[model samples]
Target: MRRDVTAIVRRRGAGHDGGRPAPRRHRAHGPAIAHSGVAHLLLAVALARGLAWPAVASQAEAASLAFPAAADARVEEERPEANFGADPGLRTDGGGDPEVRSYLRFDVGGVAGRVSRATLRLYVAAGGETADGPQVYRAGNDWREADVTWNDQPAPSGAIVDDAGAIAEEGWLELDVTRVVDGNGVYTFALFPQSGDGANFHAREADYPPQLVVATGDDRGGGPLVSTPTPPPGSGGDGAAIRASVETTPVRHGDDAADDAAVWIHPTDPGRSAIVGTDKLGGLAIYDLAGEELAYYADSTPNNVDLRYNFPVGGERIALVVTSDTDTDSLRAYQVDPATRELDDVTVRPIDVGIGVAGLCMYVSPVSGRYFAFVGDSSGTVQQWELFDDGTGKVDAAKVRTLSVGSTTEGCVADDGTGDLYVAEEDVGIWRYGAEPEAGGERTEVDAVGGGHLTADVEGLAIYYGGDGGGYLLASSQGSDEFVVYERRGGNAYVTTFSVTAGAVDGVSHTDGLDVTNAALGVAFPNGLFVAQDDRNGDDNQNFKLVPWDDIARAASPPLAVDTGWDPRRVGG
Candidate 1:
């Protein structure tokens, strides 16, 4: 391309040698030089129009774009090696040409923007004509140019970006493809007419190639600030899992039947605490802080046991321990001496379910100050009973309602503050229900039976309480030997999962049940502690392993919350 220019300059003799064109100069350069010259000429014109050239040039690439397309074809039958990408244009909405949809992909080369305008230009070569414009959609890149058939064409997104209207005479039909191309990557688009009038678009091999043009102006490239879930406050990956803060003395249950354990904190002294572990094949053993067996109540088979710090009983408050006794087929409650750290069988008649007991938990209502027990039996049924003072020294419970899982299930927990209960079906995932005494068995599955999140037969469930009804519900993913935690609020969205790897003490695997607390114990558990039954330790029988709650908290990316002020021991005391 060549151009002529004349400079009108007046000399001392006006019009004598003024405004005359010099001899034309021929220069040998490449297209880059010619493009620069053209750009300079445009810059001069823009300058005259009072425009900023740097701003215009920085947005230069956005001013124009061209792309070469590639796609799979009907090689075995039609002209496969012919190398045609998109066929001219698309005829959509039942336009009768085998329902053709042209897929085009191109790159934006990293120019960020909120598209103010976008257009897809396609050359209409031939075919029946219609007035309604074609629609464009983003598509997957699973198809190829040499092997694709109409039958195997990639399915385009159902979302319609630009619904271009009508192609009358069809030389060049432009459809707004703004929504089709946003940032980068081989972006894909599907073109189809709105109606069955049938139209054709020139292929990539045609002289007039398909082009996607997008433009954006002021206040562009702005969007909502999406973020990775932040770990709970005071939780950070600051340290590794240390040696066991304290491990219980080995149990004699030959088959690793140490099912579950709970921590009972003293009212006045935090360090004066007890761990109550169920020797499933034998009985219940209470251990003091040094892992020394303090007391043992053997004979009855206690599969799962839990304890609440304080229970208002018979004119005086006492800590209580409840267990699911398979032998008696009942939920048995006992009074715990907060000072002596001893357990006494407070023989209130056993809440009999008739089915052998499998798992059990206590729910003390933070709302109405009522205490209820959730008992589960091997017959695949769970019942909630409200326990109240019968004007006597004994505590008796009235059955509220019962729900069944239809499968062998064990291990459950009820959040008193939230009135929510979680039951783990051994071979299934954990299910959630309203823990209200009147709330029926309508359960919502928190985690399902798929993915690495949870393995079949989820065994244990625990909750780490935080202030303002915030906390984490931890599930023992027995199948994967990992514990998964979910936000206590909002559909229990997943937080993270971790395995109790080996340290000074052997790692824990095949965990049956676990418990967590945010209340500060001794210095060993500054952020509280998590006690889990280690089905596999050394060559000895299974035992309870104590892991610092802070270690678990710090290990999480978005760490779990550690409210040093929330003390269960002090809650009702």
Candidate 2:
């Protein structure tokens, strides 16, 4: 017999403590274990430091207690290698007959205090209920919906948390997941059928997607746990998946060779702009606006690269490109020739960094007219070095400031317009600091993983410049194959998220690093260009994909600004 599990979340102001806290229940189906590691430890430390959750009103506060699915997909045994991430229906079946299973993930990071009750609700599709219902088990939260397949789906962890009996009709199915969902974080669940008869539910891409209802408890009572359906932010149509119009030639080295990229705007000809990319196994590869490789320089593992324009070197203005060399733990500098679109190695001497460099970005100070290179390593240590022209007309650097985070960090970018430095601590989130040397070690968190927008292992970061300090900060949500956009000014409010899907070129996935520009680069990309390292490029070696910023801007709900007037060359001036 199926157990009645309909839980109602009463608002605190209604004079109810949401009833006594529900008794702890767990169906011992698997080994009793919990997720651990450095990331979770950091989360514990963050909470201990009193990093407050979203404010809940003390009185009659109306807040959202229901959260939509963060990610959802199904894997079918018959098509083991194929991915059905775009499908609107999630399927599940067992007992052979082309077995299938559905995965669902929710970001419950907003829930605070003690969890009184949590329910997982799914909208059953018409004629979708089967003779045998499915069992739910806790699963890993790292899988992405866009590319997950039966061959690569995350394995179910722990034992069955709950199960349901045969449903006579199709409407809504609720499963008790309170045992796995304790407080605030990401939770993933997998459902597999008990019999050969399959069942279907609406996926996040379709109408009436899965929802998570959570009720938190305090002494006064529990807050409102409204079951009202509110679409998660940036949950739009195919328009959010922009297509790539151009792709750079695959790198000479294979297997994760291409790491990071930077765009160089032509001072005189916008059409002649170039892209500077780091080939970790090879060296540096320079490509023109059409994705044609102009030159290649062989070096030992160049992890990341960034460029600044109108730099005074050798008594003349030059476009400076800087890369962090992991092999030598040093800095590699290059000068971009506007006419030939080729890079000339301009390193005067070995500017050695004590730690291995994992990420690098160039910053031109608006206050001092000085150029700085921000380099970070795997240990979360970030060092700021001031770049100067040696008497020999080559580049030299002096370390000025050092900063630290809690975990591994790779991608980073410095805004020449606002003098702000943003760093991506892979498993943590994005951190913002003042670019000025004397700015000290104080920093602010722009966003964090499990906050509902970003997944773990956050990668690259790029800023889209707009007029009047209006722009967006874009970060690579590597775990989800999407990018989270936030307003560049003020509080860094979240704008939207978009993905690079297949179009004229293949889509981009597992992107390591990326860059953007607001300067119109000829007819090919009038509103500027976005370049990213694509880890999955069909059959060939890894390469970088290019998309026009205008397409992405117009595809957003309110439409992001397509400002071509923000000159990259004038940012430092």
Clashing pairs in 2: 30-159
Q: Which digits, one per residue and each the tens of the lDDT, describe model 1 over residues 472-511?
A: 9988878777788888887998777788765434678888
lDDT of 1 at 5: 7
- Relative to the true structure, how large is the alpha-carbon lDDT of every model? 0.63, 0.75
Runs off by more than 4 Å, candidate 2: 1-239
Best by lDDT: 2
Model 1 scores what on Cα lDDT? Answer: 0.63
Best candidate, TM-score: 2
